[model samples]
Target: MEVTGRRWLLLHADEPGNCPEPSTTPDDYMGGFCAFNFTSGPAAGKFCWDQQPDYSAFRESSFGHGILEVKNETHALWIWHRNQDLYSTAGDMIYIVRQPERCLVESEVP
Candidate 1:
């Protein structure tokens, strides 16, 4: 994880993104764990504690695609490719900077 934004003053993560949401089927993480919290952006609410309500942010079984490079208007850069890895190749990348004057008053998030 890497977001150059006041939302997190620039973030970073090595893994544990958490996955296995309400799939409710197709071998959903053996049938359990799901916790995702990122409403808008910049790691919105930031979640993934223990896991149980909902999840979907892990990858490793191969086949992947998730890259966004705004590079402007606030700055952005995210990658997550696994399709054999070739186009630049990126198993995991991040870089999203956006500091809206340090805005984080979502009800003061308890």
Candidate 2:
């Protein structure tokens, strides 16, 4: 689904043993999840969650601010800064690379 102009993926663990069943009470639960690339898109060959990065910093109820700085048409810098962190510090950061030629349709290109 799309929220605030950003797209989100709903990941689920395919193997029962890889994840635990949902709990009735509110608690932190860790599980394996995966996001596959679209069959045909700029992100056609990219995948995530198979070797997932640590996301404990952004856990439930965590408050943080994020910044996405587009370096170019194909590269962007994403940073997440927690409320408790210093202004110059980044809790997490990543470079987002886009494959417009492979992912964007002709009509969508500027």
Candidate 3:
């Protein structure tokens, strides 16, 4: 995900165990998660601005808010702000889930 000011955050649903220790700037500590990259219309693998225009999708403004609702242990809904509202407005919303079979690494046997 692209954080503001041209900085970028890399995350993959397949291997999220390697996620960094959240962030301190803006004080939003991001926990590990699995999400669907709708920026590319469900293409193969995952989607990020490094290889696609996903960043442009939120080019309007960098300052935004979000709400994470955990429906279960493997599913969540993310709602992002558009920086254009006054009283908790809605912008982007998506249903994210941990697809173990589709987005995970297999254990190696010795």
Candidate 4:
């Protein structure tokens, strides 16, 4: 269940207040938004939840859902639609940017 080179992680819960501790398993993971900046190494600029506080919109519990469309290697669209909204409407949308040149090590480069 290991995931590598992933810039975004989504956690969805089926029952309200039933979110278990974070795990590799999708059904057991739940948390607010977390961003890790490797620009300064693993220990520096690590585990930041406040960088985009509003990104918490993705952490909605119970019937929360989203879709991710990768436009290319560097850009992708993330759309979160609430249960109350029409399927064509987006409750929240954001662009995910990947900086492989800046984030990946020489050996990890593709």
Candidate 5:
């Protein structure tokens, strides 16, 4: 969530400036997660990741924003606000069904 130069490296290492891909295996432009070289700073062209399918499926279908609300002790809500509907128009509201359970706190957790 925190945007920084390192994040940018991971997001965009396959651009025209970085490593040139082989023509035999035409690279999928919009897929794959990447790893950053933490030890190196803005040295350029230093990242790695496994091959991934073209990410058209996730991109085309994503079209809504939602708010996460903790209603009460036993329930929460996720309401997706669609683009077509007005702000007042409740698009898709659902009770985010949950069951509370005990959690073990780490030594660092006060």
Candidate 6:
């Protein structure tokens, strides 16, 4: 996601096992995930800024806040906000999930 700045970083990790530490930047962390490339879609295998990240089908630039509702181990809900909206309003939303079986190292059963 092309955020406003470095402070707002949206990263995709295998759950949270490879996420950055609270004290350091995401790219500067000592995580073993080196392949920060698009694995699918039009920009497959390419790095950041080289092309549009097709994995994100829709992206909008809005001035709004966000709410994160962490569900159980497998699911979570992300809700965005805007100042001009109603009390319980959401400018955007995403339902995140962890599917390790789809991210396995080498499973060709598909």
Question: Number of the top candidate by TM-score?
Answer: 6
Off by over 4 Å in 4: 1-44, 47-62, 105-110
lDDT of each: 0.55, 0.56, 0.57, 0.55, 0.50, 0.59
TM-score of each: 0.27, 0.42, 0.42, 0.44, 0.33, 0.46
> In candidate 6, where is summed lDDT lowest over 10 consecutive residues?
28-37
| Candidates 4 and 6 compared by TM-score, better number | 6
Kindly provide the TM-score of model 5 when superposed on the true structure, using C-alpha atoms: 0.33
Write one digit per residue (lDDT tens) for candidate 1, span 23-61: 332443443322333455544455433332333565379
**By how many angstroms RMSD does model 2 differ from the true structure?**
13.8
Worst 10 residues of 5 by lDDT: 30-39
Candidate number of the best lDDT = 6
Order of models, best lDDT first: 6, 3, 2, 4, 1, 5
Q: 1-110 in candidate 4: lDDT tens per residue?
A: 34557754444443334334333333323322333443453234543222334424465563658999999967899988778766567877899886765545234346
**Residue range with the least summed lDDT across 10 consecutive positions in model 2:** 25-34
Can you write out model 6's per-residue Cα lDDT over 3-38, one digit (the tens) per residue?
A: 775566665643344434433443434432334334
lDDT of 5 by residue, 46-109 (tens): 3432333354235435366888899886678888776677655656678854333322222444
Better of 1 and 3 by TM-score: 3
RMSD of 5: 15.1
Model 1 reaches what TM-score against the true structure?
A: 0.27
Residue 35 of model 5 has an lDDT of 26
Clashing pairs in 3: none
Look at candidate 3 and tell me the lDDT of residue 102: 47
In model 5, which residue pairs have backbone atoms overlapping below 3 Å?
none
